[model samples]
Target: MKRPSRRRLIAATGAAAASFSLAGCSSDSGNGDGTPTGTSEPTTDGTATQEPTTDDGTDTGGSGEPVGADQLARWVPVSDAFEFDVRAASYYDADLTALAEHESDFYTGTYGRVAQSLLGAELVDIVPPESREHVVQIVPAFTIVLRTSMSAGELATAVTDAGLSETGTQGDATIFEGAVNSTQSTVAVVEGVVVQSFGSNAQNAVETVLAARSGETARLLSNNGEVRTTVDAIGESELLVVAERPEDASSNDPSLDGAIALGYGWQFDADTSNITIGVTYTEGETAEPSALASYLTEQDAFSDYGNVGSSVEGRTVFVTGDIATNQFDLLSAGTPGESSSATDAPQVQIAFEFEDGTMTVSHDGGDSITASNLSLVVGDSPAGSQFADQYEEVTAGDSVSVDVSNVESGTNVLVLWSDGRNSQMLAQAQVP
Candidate 1:
């Protein structure tokens, strides 16, 4: 089988989390200076440190003061005890016109087009606070500076209009919060820059941005050595993601943190995408590339770990990969530890049909032995029907449909297929 490219792998798995739309049209040609050219304009200077001008052709904030690139870079805090720090920007300077061509495929139709209107840079810091016990918890804070045609207040209005509830205001920023798929998130817009955060440090993310804008001494990530090194290695790319295991990080899982640091960068072209990744291990730590691939495969963090080509240069491992545009979303379903089964598992076709407040689960292509132990499992807790030991005889080339009545809409249904000894997840479908 031909290995899938890195772009297809990321688009299939990382789209839900890492989808950030750029603002311009793209081209298939390169500018002779290594960097590819988009339809807007070609930029070869990767070291340009100028702040992007706002829509009104001004580089100043609402207060009429010039917004320095340093100020934009200093929003994310620099901490000694951090799990990771990631900073990404549009290829070479915040050229919205050039970046707009490299739009994310995650969002589609109207919402996708609207999201592409904003363009800017981002910095994220994942810090682990002190805890009493051996429990490990990481808090992530974000600082993003976006240049758009809309004003700060207008942007806040647009978010609120898009289903986010107004959660009052903090300092000069307006707050909005919402929940989706049991996960809650909060966003704060101040001075045309949006700061969004989720998880344990959601509140702190708002305060961090506010404090930084108020002239408070914010520990800037730009001052950190690890962040600078990773950014320098990234060179000219549309997106850069870096993860590091701090020296002081408690060893909750030594093997997982053995690779001290990781840097990944990607550049989107017209027909294909390019990716570069580097991984560094701790001093005296020796690990094979296959071992790292196994680790990522076990974690299921990436889909194309098996396809990733890795080589050692001194203490660091370097990987280069690419993907065509048409190869997205052609991988297996389900995530790791979430009922994932082997690809060559016994061939059985299962389908869920919901109608008239009833769910019908149909099974086919299984042998008589396989069907004798078939059972349906639903809900997370034992509060729902156990349906244990409820098996009916089914033979090969025959089909059976189990009708579950009175099922309410919006209920999460988890179906498990077992053959008395081994089990596999059949389907996870919601009532429409």
Candidate 2:
């Protein structure tokens, strides 16, 4: 296969960001405990006042007091049967409050109110069964804590009222099962914390929560040295994700095989947002960092977007940077590797037609070519002057036209196309 150009790679990254954002929106709406639906106000009576620590030494429940990072860390299950493990957490109440100002529907009515009551959440992705080889089935297990004012029964009642059926009781907790987006998900409220499992058999979710309550499971992620180091590096970000690649896993991707662990941290402030991604490679996996960085830098998506900075520390590579709030949408537009679908042939051919100070550009093949943003670069110049820009939208079809009447004659013009995320050279033409 021919190597993908930098522009194509950047486009893929933007597409991935778009997908991730869409997924978040959907997940927020139907997310087991996070779903913005519930009434029957939580009563202070019978609420758990004491913060109980699980076998892994993490606090389980309470109001006002957020779960410590250590507690959040210990929640990730460590298992050898899986190829990799991921752990993530968020302060939903704060996050939702910030979002509600712009998206009123997110905080409207009872569901919205209930969603804002959520304090924090931790999620785990378990290995898929052998039967489901083609599909990456992540049996999601999550723990969500509400305000101390809510009791376990009240939380369970709210879930049941929303649409799920109360199947049975697991110990003192009530088990509610329902089909979400065609997948049967099970949820239970233990103490003041709501534990849920989705995208798997209902029983699997119940069992995982039961194991967690009984303190029978291992705290694999928090105890790992590499994970701890990465978490420390993240240092108090509002959102965090940790992924570990198994030592024995097979993959054609060099980044997966080269790195033992990966960490991503996102910190959102009023004016600016910062995101940092770090990868820890195995000893002597020196070539992997550059290979991965080179692969990423080559993509058009990142080249024109974000103030990204990278550094090497022994066997680890850290990429950290900040982007203004307004620039965020542009950086997360198209999906990654999306430009490749436009053509299977080796090179992208850009046909340009110039007419009386006007230039029209077109490309044939690929799934679809979208250029939300267009710019013109003069020959041998490092920076391009912006001529056109689009946001969260694509100009479908195969052609786009631009006016270049102001250009000097005989100057080489490079046309760049970007759908917020990635950019590619559309065509080069010389002014007649």
Q: Which predicted model would earn the best TM-score? A: 2
Model 2, range 333-371, lDDT digits (tens) per residue? 333223222122123345557898776655544323333
lDDT of 1 by residue, 1-432 (tens): 111121122212211111211111001110111111111111212443333333422222222122222334334344321222222111112333333454443112211222221221111111011100010011123223443444677767766664568878877778887742233456677665565544334555556545544534223333334334444554565444444444443332333345555456556566565565656666577357665554444432245333566666655656655554222111222322232222223444555676665566555444343443444433221113322333445444443333445544433344443332123333344445
RMSD of each: 16.1, 18.2
Per lDDT, the best of the predicted structures is 2
Please give the clash total of every predicted structure, in order: 5, 22
lDDT of candidate 2 vs native? 0.39
- Candidate 1's C-alpha runs over 4 A off are 1-74, 79-100, 103-147, 162-186, 198-201, 212-220, 246-257, 284-315, 328-432
